[model samples]
Structure formats: C-alpha cells, structure tokens
Target: MTSIGGAEMVDWNLAVATATRLVRPGPEVGRDEARAIVAELREHARSAEEHVRGYTRMFGEDADGAAAPHDTPVLVVDRPGWVRANVAGFRAVLTPLLEKMQERRSALPGGAVLGAVGGKVTGVELGMLLSFLATRVLGQYETFAPPSFDLPAGTSAGRLLLVAPNIVHVERELDVDPHDFRLWVCLHEETHRTQFTAVPWLRDHLESEIHAFLAETDVDPSTLLERLHEAGQSMTGGRASGEDGEGSAAESRSLVEVVQTPAQREILGRLTAVMSLLEGHADYVMDGVGPEVVPSVGEIREKFQQRRAKGAGRLDQALRRLLGLDAKLRQYRDGERFVRHVVDRVGMAGFNRVWTSPNTLPTKVEIAKPADWIARVHGDAGN
Candidate 1:
C-alpha cells in the first residue's frame, strides 16, 4: 500500500490492520441498544456545539477576518474507526518528516536494506501503540485531518470524532447518567472543535510547530540507536541518580522525553504549553457549562477525576508513564488552572486575547504562572 515513504519508513495499511486486530473490543450491547447509543451520541454531539458556543462565545471565524460557517464534520465511530481516522491523521502529518527521514536513511550504507525491514517493524510498533490508545480515547477533535471534498464550502477540514462504544463503556463503568455523561463528553470535544475553528490560525500554528519539531530529527542510525537505548533505560528504571540522590525524576521520564534533542525539547515545551491551554480550556468550558445543563455533572466530574487518578494495573501504568500519558494527565489539571485563573482575574474576553495571534499565546512558564500571561497579554489593563 502507498505510504509517506513508499512503505520504506512505515506501512500505513499494516499499522491500521495491526491496530484493528490487536485493539480490545469495546463493551458489548445488543444490536438495537448499540444503534440507540450511536444515535444518542450523534444527537448530543450536534446539540453540544450550541451549548459550547453559547458559553464560550466563539464563532468559527478565520484570523484573516473572513467569516466562515461552522460546518465541521462530526463522526460517531467505534474503536476501529477511531483507529483508522487517527492513523490517517498520523500519516498525513508525518508525511513530510518521514520523507525527509527516508532521504537521510537512503544515504547510509546498507540503509535501503535496513529500511525494508524497519518499515514493517516500525509499522507494527505504531500499531501496538495505537491499539493501546484506541480504547482509551473517548473522543477527539482531529486538527490535522487532510482537506476533504465532502466538507461544505468555506468549512474547515477539521473533524470531530466521538468514540461511541468507549463513551458507553465509560458511562457504564462510572455508573453515571448515560445522557449526562454523553453530553459532558461532547461538550469537551466540541470545545476543541470551537477552539480550532474559531481561531483559524490555531490549527495551522500547531501544525507548523509539529512540523518544526519533526524537521529537527536526528536521522543518523547511531543517534537513533542511542535514543532507543536511552528509552530502554528509562523504561527499565535505569537512569542515573541526580544530586537529590533519588533519581525519581529521571526514572519518570517518558519514552517521548528520552528520544528528544535539546532543540526538540524547546519546541516540545512550547507545544506542551499550547496543548495545556487547549485541554484546560476545554475542561474549564465543560465544567463551566455543566451545572446549568447537566444535572449529574458534579457526580460525573468527581467520579471521572477519581478514575483518571486510579488508572490501571502495573503494566498499564508503566506503559502510561513511558508513553508520556502521565504528563498529559497533568496538562488537564495545569491547563485548567491556567484558564480558570486567567478567566477569574481578567474575564473570558481577556482570556480570548490569547486567540488574537500566536504572539499573545502563553510561554511555558507563563502557563504555570497565569498572572504573568495576564500581565504580558493585557498589560496594565489586566491589573
């Protein structure tokens, strides 16, 4: 099958097949019940956007001052469908970087031979990773999905995906009101859709940051091997102790952290800050819009937070740590605090200034210290 690097760097089809094969099945219900669940999720997804827009007061307008209608597509998909959409997104975004890496790999002696085998191996690894994630993600707003002819005229290509089975599974697990829980999930996902669609530059800005990060790749075989070794050590709890003599922090570094160069780390920091803002803002909006509409919102929030903290078994927890999912969990808490603080101090209008331009976006430090972001973005006006 065709791929970013002619199947030399990754076999996209193999990855999808592998993920679909390995992903655990979602919770089961009768055919009629399943149909009902999907229908309910779609209904909630459509209406959730109105609630999100009403609360956040954001319209899907471009930064160029060109007003566009909000017609972003919404798909209520099962686990395998979620996997396919994400694989497509990954392939699209990683295409340029993979092509560049392929060029570098081809220059090395015996590189062509290594690539043929490496492609299959990498594809399998990616599939395994996606399989793990496929079941966990309840919904997502795909920021980098390629342009589609199916989208309406003047509509952004971004698509919102709701993993119907997982949502049902979580609601069952949490034993919360199915209707309340479903709407709650949509509120968060729709907020993301609004964030990207409202601030048109956001999607492109994030894509550029990702491309910039990928462009800094060290494709040398030896460097790649070293990163693998570092990752192994990280996974095995082998990092050397720091001055504190505990080495806890070093041991806790994810595979994502072990593989990065200093340059990539700087970019990662910036990306992290941006993600923190997005996730936090969504979380804030969900809760902010919750009490008024979702009667069981308080219970859902309490139980969901507990579930996130509880996590899974030892192996799963270890994988989560290595995959940087733990860092992601922190992003929710930190980002929400940042948004809440800024909104509490300066109001939503002041917080909206962040979307004015990339320049107004918070730096990594400013995310942790909202006062600084307020001071910098709003100057004396914020005070």
Candidate 2:
C-alpha cells in the first residue's frame, strides 16, 4: 500500500477493479432480448472458428493440424466484462516494463516514497485509459489471460470474447441488419484467433518483441524533457541530425514512437511489420467473405468507415492521436492493402511463405510497397 505523490504505481489489480465498471452502460435489454442474444451466441458456438478456418484455407493454412489449442473458448461479455478482460491483457503485456520501472525508482534516494507515488500515478493513468477504450471498441478478439479475479485453477480458460453490448449498440445505431453485422464482427475477430493459433511461432514472436520494447522503456525526467524539447524544435523548424547525423524521424512522435532507442526502433519496426500483416490479413479475409453471403456487408463497411472518421469529441480524439492509436488504425488499412496487392500478384499460396519463417516477414516500409517484398522474398528463394 506504499504510495508516491499520494499514488501507487503498481496496483493494476485495484486499478482494473475500480475502472472496469466505470464505462458507459449500453442500452438495456429486456429479459427476452437478453435471452435471444445469448441463445444465438451459444447456438453458433463455433461459428466464428469454423467460418474463419474455412476462409483461411485460401491463405495456404487450414484448420487441420493448426497449432492453436482448441481448449481456448470464446465467450460473450458486457462492457464491464470487456474492461475486466482487457485489463488482464494489459497486465500481462505491461508487467515487464512496470517491474523494470519500479526497480529503477526504488534505487533512488527516497526510492520507497517515489516508487509508491509513481506506481500509483501510472496505475491510475492506465485505468483511465482502459475505461475510455471500453466505451469505444465494438468487438475485440482478445487473446490473453482472463483477469486475475477469475482464476482458481481450471475455472476460466477463455481468451476470446465478443463485447456483446457494444455489438448491439452499433447495430441499433447503424440500423443495418443485426444478423449480418454480428456475423461480420465475428469474422473479423475469428480471423485474429486463427492467425495466432494457426501460426505457432506468431504469439511468441509478438511477446518477445513486446518484451524487448518494454525493456527499453526506462525513461528518466531529464532525458524525456530533452527529447521533448528536441522534438518540438523538429516539428516547428527542421529535423535535427541525431547527434550522430543519422537524421531519423524520432522528432515529435507519439508516445509509443518517441520512447524508442535505435535498437528498440529496429525491433519496433519488425513488430510493426508483423502486426500490420496480422491486422491486414484479417481485414483482407473479412472483406473477402463478400457481400453475397452477408447481404448488408457493403453498408456496414460504409457506415463503419464513417464511424471511424467521426471524432468522439476533442478529448477522445486527442487521446487517440497522442497514444498512437491513430497509427494502429493505419495498420489495418496499410496491412489490408499490402495483403490484397500481394495476393493479387503472387496469389495466396505465395503469400503463405510468410508464415513459413519469421525471416520472410515484411518491414514497415515494405508493408506499403509489396513489390519490394516480392522481389526480396523471391530473390532469397532463388538464392
């Protein structure tokens, strides 16, 4: 219960508990509608799994002998439930960074006092961030552990979920066919499931990169201030040659971008390429499912794009921009275009080579330029 600046830095358990329920409550359902939604979800238990597997066969990998453990169950959840789920994911991803940060603070003169306050502030900031996201996301193919609250051995082995309330809300607001929208959302999420599970090395590849990124995130006040000052000058005037004349693009970047060291930046580049591929592949699959099967698919795409374009007010939009979430959205677009172009030229079988080994993965620049990737990959094969 130690604290700094009247805050604790590492109480994610408490932060998640407090913030999970603070999200906007979705429209209330009568008992009948509730039962219907649940029943439909339950009835189509493996609908996403089955459909995604079928679609991905066209990508050169099928469900057969796929490495993903089938024991991972898909669950349906409300907004508060989604918050609980995501906080657990954040916990797993951020734990390494948090541990390293706390250790550094504890090494200071008033290490004890600073550690508590810093942990508290960081936890609170993260909680507020999660709560805000809970109010926005419609569907997520969550793949981390369940919240610490749910484990007592063999209790909840879940890693997949649909934010049921948000789905219903968007369906209502858009006035599109409910069934079509639900299926479409499932297709997108299920694609994520297949990507991680089917490709054995992918999950660990991502985990390792995240660990590397977090390991490099040891920021001190003076260094950060200096970076901020240099970044400001870069934006207002001109990009400075790094004291090394490298003249990199680190100037005035987002939170995720500015924190990188050069080595970490290379790692980040690889990760960005991989994530773009995953997201882009998923987008490609979902769209490829086509409007013929899902009648309102076109309308949903149009309305969804409109929704993404509209800002949720100044504060929300500002937060997304600063946090690099805007870049995240760009990943989907950039990735989809990459996948589509690659498939068009080389076909799905050729693209499947990417999953054969991490070495074949595209860099960030190559994601935007498929021909470069094609030439390099084909040349390497020739060698």
Give the Cα error of residue 54 in candidate 1, in Å: 1.0
Q: Candidate 2: where are CA atoms >4 Å away?
A: 1-8, 42-45, 58-69, 146-158, 221-253, 379-383
Q: How much is the lDDT of residue 347 in candidate 1?
A: 89
Report the number of the highest-lDDT candidate. 1
lDDT of 2 by residue, 233-286 (tens): 332343433434554323325667667888888888888899899889988887
Q: Across residues 36-82, which tens digit of lDDT does each residue of candidate 1 receive?
A: 98888888888887788888877645698644546788888988999
Q: Identify the runs in model 1 with alpha carbons over 4 angstroms from their true place.
A: 1-6, 60-69, 148-155, 219-255
Deviation in Å, model 2, residue 244 alpha carbon = 35
TM-score of 1: 0.88
**Model 1 residue pairs with clashes:** none
